[model samples]
Target: MTTDGPPARRLMRWRNAVWLAAAVLFLLNFVQRGIDLFSIILTAIVVALGFAVEHVETQTRRPFKNYLRVALASFALGLVLVAMPLLMGAGIWIGLILWAGLSGAALFWCTYYERTEPR
Candidate 1:
């Protein structure tokens, strides 16, 4: 069966906070260019942390392996994003699109294969 009530409510609150933080970071990146490297790194770390938080909040168990994989992916993506402007001489718009697409895919993977321990 499904769960309901306080626990679910708390989880929702945590999820909202994470999403808000991610959005704010993304917006900040859009408005500022001097800190592109820092922003990219911070965004990746934030996204990874958010995923870990969601996993813990939902499953009540820490999946270290999955977390490590996500962290590595985030870092690698961030590096690629940081290089896009220099490597391709592309504008921030293109970089943002790529970042968004990559981030969305990562989030989707997390949701699609959420951990569930055996009884």
Candidate 2:
């Protein structure tokens, strides 16, 4: 009387195996194609621009020119970061490391300036 129940369980197992196989195939495709840089560059630019806006709000009390100056500087820096790999023939990992180093240096400089400047 329970034969139909066993068939349902068997079908469920096969369905799970098929789903797992499809998922594995999808993952392998991505591993083969490698990561892309365009999205990364766009993300970096947005973040840098956001930081520039924040910096202008907090650090610069001057007119709109100062805001433009800070924002433009940050944008230029981000552009250079995004172009480093193409310009230097560096791999993605090296470009990321270079960007990190430059960002760290900029952060340090800002920290020092904030401490030393009159509030």
Candidate 3:
């Protein structure tokens, strides 16, 4: 049990490192591209990866309803983000902050509601 603890800790640390690296890379890509099409692509890829991670962690097959909900949420969020510059015009920064907050909230909701039992 003692030996297993160290191995488990090491694996956890490695997993964290991988996630951190992915986040940093995504950030760099967004910053370099100035949050246009590239940002959308990156966000989609990240979201897909997140879904995959959730699938693995929960050990359950994807539910159609959940997938539909996620897709609708993502589309709505993307629309808001795309319209932000035009809607706010003078306060683009505020729109960006709102977009970030919305994304965070959506991710939290998904994580919290994700089913853990096999389906």
Top model by TM-score, which number?
3
* Model 2 weakest lDDT span, ten residues long: 62-71
Q: List residue ranges in candidate 2 displaced over 4 A.
A: 1-75, 83-90
lDDT for model 3 comes to 0.65
Deviation in Å, model 3, residue 98 alpha carbon:
41
Q: For model 3, state the Cα shift of residue 95 in Å.
A: 38
lDDT of each: 0.67, 0.60, 0.65
Considering summed lDDT, which 10 consecutive residues are worst modelled in model 1?
Answer: 60-69
lDDT of 1 at 45: 65
Model 1 over residues 22-68: C-alpha lDDT tens digits?
79879876687655776677677667766765665466544555555
Q: Which pairs in model 3 have colliding backbones?
A: none
In terms of lDDT, model 1 sits at: 0.67
lDDT of 3 by residue, 81-112 (tens): 75645644654666667777877787667666
Q: Considering lDDT, where higher is better, how would the candidates rank from best to worst?
A: 1, 3, 2
lDDT of 2 by residue, 1-119 (tens): 45656766777676568657755664575577654675445545655665675456556664443436544655566567656566667666665666667766666666666667665
The TM-scores of all predictions, comma-separated, are 0.37, 0.34, 0.38
Model 3, backbone clash pairs (residues 3+ apart or across chains), number: 0
**Angstrom error at residue 25, model 3:** 0.9
